[model samples]
Target: MQQSAVPELAHTHARPIHWVATATAVAGVIALSSVAQPGSATAAQAAPGTEAKSAPAAAAPPSTTGVTFPLDCGPVKAIVVKKATGDLDGDGRPETVAVVHCDAPMGTPPDGVYVLTRGADNPKPRVVATLVDPKDRRTVTDFALRARTVTATLLGYSTADVPSCCPDLKIPTTWRWNGTAFVRSTTATAHSV
Candidate 1:
């Protein structure tokens, strides 16, 4: 057997008191860690000399239900065919773009594209703009709201002789809020359906 040059230290041995001291030290560290906490996080820092202002809570999009659209649907009730929501006017709140039409028993009813918005004080949604009038005799299709713009494919007749059952002209249209009003623009050339 070979002999060691140095003797073993007393601290190296696992005594009951050593375990109690280690447990007490670990417990103290855990207790101190539980008492300490980090500050709340923020997205952006404010400019110098200005107080930090928290952003307002997000608002829900305007609803189309019970909104009396300007369309004159004789005896039948007007129904919302398609709806999309976004901040159309660069405002903090969202506006709803709804494609509404009469609940006719037969034949293709022309759709009315209406922009609806709810005021901060008013809870009910109101029609703000009429993008497509039902009187134009156009049916709305592929309607959507993207990048603060409203887009839709309008199906219409080229002339009075054209049958209502079969629309001849297809127009890809888009409406954008231009500070004061909703400006209409065509994305592509009109084609026959």
Candidate 2:
């Protein structure tokens, strides 16, 4: 064997102490990396010479709590079955569309859909419009708020002879605000269930 020019280094040989020191250094590097993280990336870039202005926080939709609905439930209290929120009136504030019905013990009670909004003058949420009245004997299903429009599948009876327990007709309906009032438009003809 030929003799090497450089002297044998202690680090060249594998030792328990050397392994422990290397493991400790690796663990320290992992811990430091975890502690130091990059900031979140954003797509929007501010123009030069102009300060970036953060967008104003949007107002929360009106809540159904503490708001009295126009329902005449003799004994049972009115309960909110389903709800959706969106900007309906183009006022930047969101409105809550709630499907409310009497908490009947036996039969399926009819549902009433109401649009609720909180005005600047009044802090409490109030029903601004009644999309579906309970007196109409329609049950709201598949309800949604999309693109400032309220859409729903209305389950109703074809005639008075149809029992309340089962709805025979299904109608897909949508309501949109026209600056004055909410105009209701049925997307499809009523069909048998």
TM-score of each: 0.73, 0.75
Top-scoring candidate (lDDT): 2
Give the Cα lDDT of each candidate. Answer: 0.93, 0.94
Which predicted model would earn the best TM-score? 2
Steric overlap count per candidate: 0, 0
Candidate 2 has which clashing residue pairs, if any?
A: none
Worst 10 residues of 2 by lDDT: 184-193
In TM-score terms, candidate 2 sits at 0.75
